[model samples]
Target chain A: MNALLEAQGLHLRFGAVRALDDVALSIWPGEVVAIVGESGSGKSSLLRVLAGMQRADAGQVLYRDAAGATHSILDASDAALRRLMRSDWGFVHQNARDALRMEVSAGGNVGERLMAAGNRHYGNIREVAAHWLERVEMDPARIDETPKNFSGGMQQRLQIARTLVTSPRLVFMDEPTGGLDVSVQAKLLDLIRGLVADLGLAVLLVTHDIAAARLLAHRIMVMRHGQVVEEGLTDRVLDDPRHPYTQLLVSSVLAA
Target chain B: MIVLHTEALAKSFTLHLQGGVSIPVLRDVELTLRAGECVALAGPSGAGKSTLMRCLYGNYGADSGRILLRHEGAMIDIAAADARVMRAVRRDTLGYVSQFLRVIPRVPTLDIVAEPMRARGVAPDEARARAAALLTRLNMPPALHGLPPATFSGGEQQRVNLARGFAAGHPVLLLDEPTASLDAANAEVVIALIAEAKAAGCAIIGIFHDTAVRQRVADRLFQILPVYEPA
Candidate 1:
């Protein structure tokens, strides 16, 4: 039971602000670990650092591949990282506009990841892309439509389909349901939960919404001032928060 | 064989805003359940019945003692189980039916009931067929199966919740006033469901305020006494 991803002693600073302070976390295979806090709490920074998109001032990020070899993600060559991202890892951005190729058709957007993974058969790529679209509850008829014409929730679903089409074992999701209508967010969260379980994905999820975390995460880490104030089982942390900051954060969510 | 038990379980709530006043709800409470038995939690108001239920469900952290249940052929103390173990245990061994239906908005009733089965790796077609069968048994019309339960009446919503809870068919089940919102006929359906579950060797714990319902379904009564004290 080796950790799929592990980070230790992470410290990142921007001028006078400590973006991440001695943060440490691990995600096991097929596990969903949520990092939650208010804005500027460094949750997003930790996700980015763990995903190898951003460098921490000091820390060790270890990733164990399926072949049982552990690699230092922070020190990996850019080429190696790119190959890893295309094959073994997936990232879903908060804004679909940031993750999606707005000009590409939905099917092309999903097929690009397959192409990067070395799937050269055009018919197979299109078929797999259409299957992924259906898996995410999108209409296959819209596969030729560019994402720009889709609504916000539909675009996010398309982004998820594109990121997941290659069957990445580990995913880094930063506010996957952010900026959607409340009803849409709930539906999207349910879809994500089902897909994560179906695919057995190990996820590093960064979200400010406690309810979403409760619904999707197995464990929860509460951050404040770039430090983890509390971490435990999702229900335990939400129901019996030991840290004052975590308690305040949990209590502040308005009841729906 | 015993399916679940609690040993000297204790729980208390501290009010942070009320000058940190501590309210003891349960203290040294011991309870047990056997396969094919229904234990009804009986007590007056504020007697910690719901607290004990929540503790067993891992919604509330126990202050002390063990809430142990047989999971995967081993007696695991849920009070100390980590999130991963707890999730697995809940997925494979424990089931709960609360008084109301709480589901993601816009998820149709059939999918809501079938989702748990789908998570357990059941095929979509079979899971929906089972969910449809259960909902039909509970008198939910097929016309409403494609609609969400958000706008349903209280009794109708509870039926949906019950169907979802029972669809998983875990070895142990917890019912928190499951029939509180149901009519007499619906309550009868629930009694039958409980009987069928027990016949299949599922251990159950329930809180039923309706004495008739309790007498009909409960094999025994576990009384929970209040532990409140004035400061």
Candidate 2:
């Protein structure tokens, strides 16, 4: 697999707290890398830095498109990163509404990504939105209703549709099934696994669920206290955890 | 014990596009909630869960139905209550956290979280103190208390919304997907807070499709039929 994205020696800080220290991550084309950690373990900070929301103190994030050209995201300006997000990258938060506009119709939210990509015709937007909504298991008729009226899980699904509709090459999902029930989480994880495989898009998944990591990730990187402690093939790491922190995390899930 | 009850509650909107076309949004539905209870609404999109909730909160007018709130002696006709009366009722009685609309530009995070107390006539100093306490409970720092919520991330903003709804000290607190985007750890804290608020005599009506949240807070689960086929 080709290295589609890479992060090298990334260092981040929030005030005096060391959020990320000499962190490194790399994503191959059509591979899902799960970054797993405890609550204060700096998983979110790393994702934010890579996504260009927060600037890292040092190091670099490099992306190599299919053309063999490498782009350094760490040095890119905010405007340049946003332009990249518009066409080539997708980011999904744990909450769907944050990634969406609530006041507008649900169709508008999905179509807006297309709009950002320059599709302005309402009919075309509605058509693509409905098609994607069906793919995400939402009602096509309610496509006209505002997201405020949609259930929590439904809204999240709408968000996934919005992101996937753009057909971006790389996507970042932060605990996509975080607040959902086990049954729903299972279903959504399955849906995501299938979609990521079918789309053949590279993914960087940050999550707390070990089961989710086992299911979706090609490789797992265990983090603790703002650092990566263990990294390897997910099944091997989960089956035979070398790091003590990875053992603790795997054991807690087992003991539960 | 049934503090809130709706009979055949229905609401619909006319969706007028380029051509003056009309469409029905919500069908006639029924719902009930008792004192100190939390219920979860689960269904696919366009199932009218949000429309039903808006009517219950009196934000949207119900087309045809009876909404009665159980008072000390009798059931008050909430549907018939005047605007001023409804405003007063909402002030002291209800708390709400919608899915979005959480960001209050230029207002400090702590101030926005404490706006509920101010609305209910809590003193300025007391409200600020209370807001600080609320943020502390959510594990947010004191420094963030003075900064605008617009500066926070999605997870942080959701926590602000959660703290505001849970700590408002109202009889009825309504939350729409309060933890929808929160991670497992944050979601667990939010669920515990919801149960804590419920134990404190607050009637909670929250909508969630997450099974974990439903299992955590929903004493009685309302299994509405999904409008779409299961994925």
Candidate 3:
């Protein structure tokens, strides 16, 4: 199958820092690819560039739609990019509060996404919001409550609900379970894994924790100094790392 | 000794707009709760489970019932208690986590969770510290602690509500759908918190729709069937 998304020779920089250098990757439909590296290794910058949240200095990021039309994310108009973000793509932030509206009710937050897709009926919108809340393991009774009333885990869960409510074909997640307790992270990983399998979504995930990547990603890309040093099947990479850096990364996690 | 007991609790509503139609929600319910007891109420939707909890919490008036509570060396009937007495009971003896969180806007979540302890005359610093501890255990991010919960997601709001209710260590606690909005991980934390509360000798009455949660926390089960009468 043709890849659902592809990035070729992508490059980005911040002053003297080369945030991403000649990064190239592809994600097939119903696949999960995780980008793993240490802090400032350019994994996040690469993800941001691919997700169209940041502009790259050079390279092409192409998304092949379900209809087989390839669209260049960098060349797409702002309105077109916004529509894609609202309808066909999702981004899950490490800090959920940054992605959610702090002043809106829980129902309003989810319902707004539906409204953006042209749903206008109040009853219908609220019903879908409630359904998404329950799907995310949240109580629908607090639909009128705000995100500020929620704990970190619940906020993250709600953020997932908000993003997935539209059933986007592709999702970009940045450390979805970071800053959570070990036990909480474990459960969240299970939820994410289940949802990804059920929805058949193509996902590009960025995380420093190898365990999370191992659990959720089908393919793993190890990055160092703004370049992908190694890439392969998740189990293969973890079980037998060819790159020395990949070996060190895996061993460091085990040592910790 | 039973810390709380309800004798033949009954409730009905008259819908005047619907031509005075009488709807009986609860019928002659009897329950007994001892210290360190956790009882889960299980029932279908519209089965008066929440109505019974509301009645137990003194949020709804009972047409006929005896909600007796052992509070501060006195056995008080919450169903018949005056507003002032009920307020005192709620302040010092009862803690409730309703289906939704209701609060004034602009009060920070930390202070909101700390209010129960503050009401019991605990020092602000100590109460806040305890509140922070509970919030952390529930996996509430520290960055949002200073902000108000008025704009929080349903699940996040529920955690703050749970933290506030659990903070006080009230003698008699009522929880309605306590874990309904939480994921397995956060839900497990709540289970542990409930266990700790039970160990501390609190008497709990809760409605848990999640069977797993009920299985982990409940010592016994109470069934509330929907009450219907001849039209």
lDDT (Cα, tens digit) per residue for candidate 3, span A1-256: 7988889998888999888889999888778889999999999999888888889999999998878888899888888889889888999999998889989999998999889988899999999999999988899999999999998888999999999999999999999999999878877887888688668898999999998888788778999989999876675567546567886787778622
Better of 1 and 2 by lDDT: 1
Give the CAPRI rating of model 2: incorrect
**Which residue pairs of candidate 2 clash?**
A94-B181, A95-B181, A180-B210, A181-B210, A181-B211, A181-B212
Which lDDT tens digits does candidate 3 get at residues B1-231?
A: 699889999988654445556788999999899999999988899999988887787766778979999989788898887544666788899999987887544569998898789878899899999999999999998887899897889999999999999999898899999888888899999999999999999999999888878898999999999987966
DockQ for the candidate 1 complex? 0.40
Write down the TM-score for model 3.
Answer: 0.53
Which window of 10 residues has the lowest lDDT sum in candidate 3 chain B?
B13-22
lDDT of 1 by residue, B1-55 (tens): 9989999999998766557778899999999999999999999989999889989
Query: Candidate 3: where is the Cα deviation over 4 Å?
Result: B1-231
Candidate 1 positional error at A12, Å: 3.2
Off by over 4 Å in 2: B1-231
Best by the DockQ measure: 1
| Cα lDDT listed for each candidate | 0.92, 0.79, 0.87
Query: How would you order the candidates by lDDT, starting with the best?
Result: 1, 3, 2
